[model samples]
Target chain A: MTEGVALLTVFVLAVFVGFEVVSKVSSTLHTPLMSGANAIHGVILVGAVIVAGTADEAGVLVVALIAVVLATLNLVGGFVVTDRMLEMFGARRPEAAAKDGAE
Target chain B: MIAVWAQVCYVVAAVCFILALKGLSSPKTARRGNLVGAFGALLAVVVTFIAYDIDNLGWILLAVAFGAVGGAMGARRVAMTAMPQLVALFNGVGGGAAALVALLELSEPARAGITRPAGFGDDGWFAYSPLAESGGHTESEILRMVDLLSTGTLTATAFTVLIGAVSFSGSTVTFLKLQELMTGRPITFPGGPIVFGAVLVAAVGLGLWAVATGSVTLAIILALVGLLAGVLLVLPVGGADVPIVISLLNAFTGLAVAAGGYVLENALLLVAGTLVGASGTILTRAMAHAMGRSVSSILFGAFKGGSTAGGGEASDRPVRSAGPDDVAIMLAYARKVIVVPGYGLAVAQAQHTIRELVDLLEKRGVEVGYAIHPVAGRMPGHMNVLLAEANIPYEQLLEMDTANGQLRTADVALVVGANDVVNPAARTSPGSPIYGMPILDADHAGAIVFLKRSMRPGFAGIENELLFDPKTTLLFGDAKASLTALVSALKSL
Candidate 1:
């Protein structure tokens, strides 16, 4: 198989496994996990930018550029909003703070 | 040269995802895990940029700048109360983008020439050529006889686009309903079931047509039909089933994106999409179980408005009013206090004040814990998320199973802006609509202090028989103000 095909297969399988694992986790962890995964989606920005700059085809470049913008907005915006939510829940508990300080 | 490093970065990012998932299993380390996962993503992006073979940087830089601006604006403006709506919007955007990717694939010239294989043997699946035999390649006559076929990339792309569009539009509607921008009442037609069936059939027919003809236009039309179907499917579902619909739609979005990733041959996209799809599906099932409803029943919009009897009778029951001093006296000397939170707490935005009250009680050597019912608010796990925002310790936020066990042992059950979830009628009254539905056993507490706006029945439109019980006392007013006054009275005592 070609290198691209190999990469694609690995990614698909990994996603399937990842989904299985995430599904088993307690409901309490859903928001935090999503928040984390969303942040990681920011990587799509770099990929988009790269694809946009390298593609000789103008249409492909335009779409790639657009993807980059959307993905980045999703990434940065999602994190900031989520962090603010965490803060609203109240300042960290004394025990949590103590642990943080120790670390 | 940089491709090697980019590949390494992808590997590292994947590992981070695994670790993050592991960390998210427990609340204690969730934040740290999230941070680690984010860093991994950042590393992957940066590495990809460095390895990119680009001659022109200006346009790419411009796109990046635009994204930065948009991200900053949205992050700064949106409030915590609207976070769920914002999440829905973001999920929609993701699905939309995936659909756009599919659309772009369809526009590719090379894709237009692709056609379904003529036939297949007894296996009933088409086999693509591993090699191009030059001129005069012999076609298998037997293979041509059987019309067994496999859907090609274009057909897959079209399906992805259709499903993604539907998920996007449907999620937007759900978000609007939750934000109160749209009415929460189920929009049902006279022949709702028949309409739903017709739409389902049409959607399937369109899918088949697109596959057989390899027509992008036909696929686009199918997408529109699916989009309409999505709205129709969710419209007749009542407020009670909104949470389940949200979960189910979320799963749909994930699956759609996964299909898009397959069309685009993107590894990261596939992985992320599948993760979201699977998790959302499980959560949907769990939510259905929590509500004592089947997934099929939820889909068919079997449950809509609340029972009629509870609302009128609940308003007629006499409520005993309590002053801050009365509340303070009861709470000040309490050995164990359990706070039951409901939709009113969310409405009053009183989570912060409630957290403060918990702290004050702990300071006075009183044990305070929160009792959270599974479907306490507008969504599943709503109370936990709200309490978490107020920095309530994960341990203090007790689930119904755990909290129910401790209600009888408590000195007082201070119900803050709560209703139906604490109703004893559900367990005792066999004729009641909500009978057999598990609730927090707040009625069993030595004393119950309920702080609500009025003696209104909860979202389920059923009277909480607990309100009329001798053990219960109602403190009427805004939850925030009531809690503030109660806090001061406790301080004075």
Candidate 2:
């Protein structure tokens, strides 16, 4: 009936829907799924920044500031690391030259 | 007016998230998906700031600057091999942040008197929400009562933080092992089971105590217990099972994040966390089935005894040895060839070389395809990702079920750095650990060429019975070097 109750109900349903999507996907896609989801940490960054800016209380403000920093690090750092790892698989080897001549 | 714009931006961000997820489902579009997700995140952050009602500009700027510098440094420095470890570390941070947020909300002085809705009324629904408002109860009194009840939000947060921290550390260890920075052997104790049982009991007991007393201190102790439990849980698992363990730990991290999300009442956190948790669980289950092991058996380290070296008596029988010249000549003239990859290919970082070798074979009018075992490397689908990176065609990368039937019809089965996946032990010995686990029948082919570093046992810690078969010929060397030599010899022919 109330706004709070409505927010809570929607939140609960969104989580359930998210779980359903995860269950239906194949296991072979796990790594890529994670790489995609890790980017979503940026949402946490947004939340942290908002909380930091708006909270009047000193304690809340301090915590929000810390959260913002951590969340940003996670978002950017995770992508960089994942990209570098993917590069290892994509790089062409020097020995490939020998195979080229042979073919 | 700002709220309206912010809502619009949120909608846009949600769309981007959906599209990013769809793109990431296939390797060809994964990079684009990553970029789209990043843009969505950037949009969400900028929009949130625009709508935020903040009076203190100084603190906000400092936080942003610090976040930017730290993030840039981490991104620039971390290696690709350590990406999974970094993921674990970030998962820990997310869970920890959620736990901290929940605690701060509960301890807020302004919201001190708000009581738990009477409608909830001991229904045990709030059992997971430790900080649920309880009417007519002082903070200290409620804390004491919650300590006694232990099943509330505090317990959930504590458990999440504890598990997340352990996953972070354990994943780092696994990354090092995979990269050859650490030994791939299983670290086990003489009485590992008893110690594991004790830790589990302590963790549960302390968790209950923290809930009953609503004591944050006790919750912290419970967290430590969980942290130790995670380390103990993973240490005894051998190299062969690392992929499954990594998948399982990924699941644990996901569940922890979801718990934290529930505590913080954040919709995005819940959505992302639940998605990761459920997927990780399914992957762990699939990997376990592929290995012919139960989840419980993996957790308790009961499968170690079956992984004996030299268990295959047939390995003593003499087998043929093939030089690169002979093998290349045969392959160059062959109509069709199927390449079976194993951990050895991964160890030598030879996927690119293999890809080149395949190209050479194709130029000779040979139909070449790859046979992928479900549990080939340290992780599920490890070979697929590696091969895909070399720009291998999806049509050529065949699953075991599809590829197995074709192996017998092929002119040659050129197994590169693979072992147990092609071993005949799975079929011949019902008593073996990998007995029922499906394998590629490389022996059934007209000719078999095994490329291996040595005669060492594979992940199961047992000698491959296929290695000694009369039909199989051993071509020993580093996979990259061996494949290169084969290419040269083929060109000479």
Best by lDDT: 1
TM-score of 1: 0.80
B235, model 2: CA deviation in Å? Answer: 1.2
Clashing pairs in 1: A15-B271, A88-B389, A89-B389, A89-B390, A89-B391, A90-B389
State how far residue B417 of model 1 sits from its true place (Å). 1.5
Deviation in Å, model 1, residue B21 alpha carbon: 2.3
TM-score of 2: 0.78
Among all windows of 10 consecutive residues in model 2 chain B, the one with the lowest summed lDDT is B113-122
- Model 1 chain A scores worst on lDDT over the 10 consecutive residues at A38-47
Predicted structure 2: lDDT: 0.64
Off by over 4 Å in 1: A1-16, A34-69, A79-103, B1-8, B43-65, B72-77, B110-150, B290-293, B305-314, B359-365, B375-382, B393-395, B429-436
Model 2 Cα lDDT, one tens digit per residue, B314-376: 344566888999888888888989999887886677776888789998988899999988767
State the weakest 10-residue window (summed lDDT) of model 1 chain B. B141-150
- The most accurate candidate by DockQ is 2
What is every candidate's alpha-carbon RMSD to the true fold? 6.4, 6.3
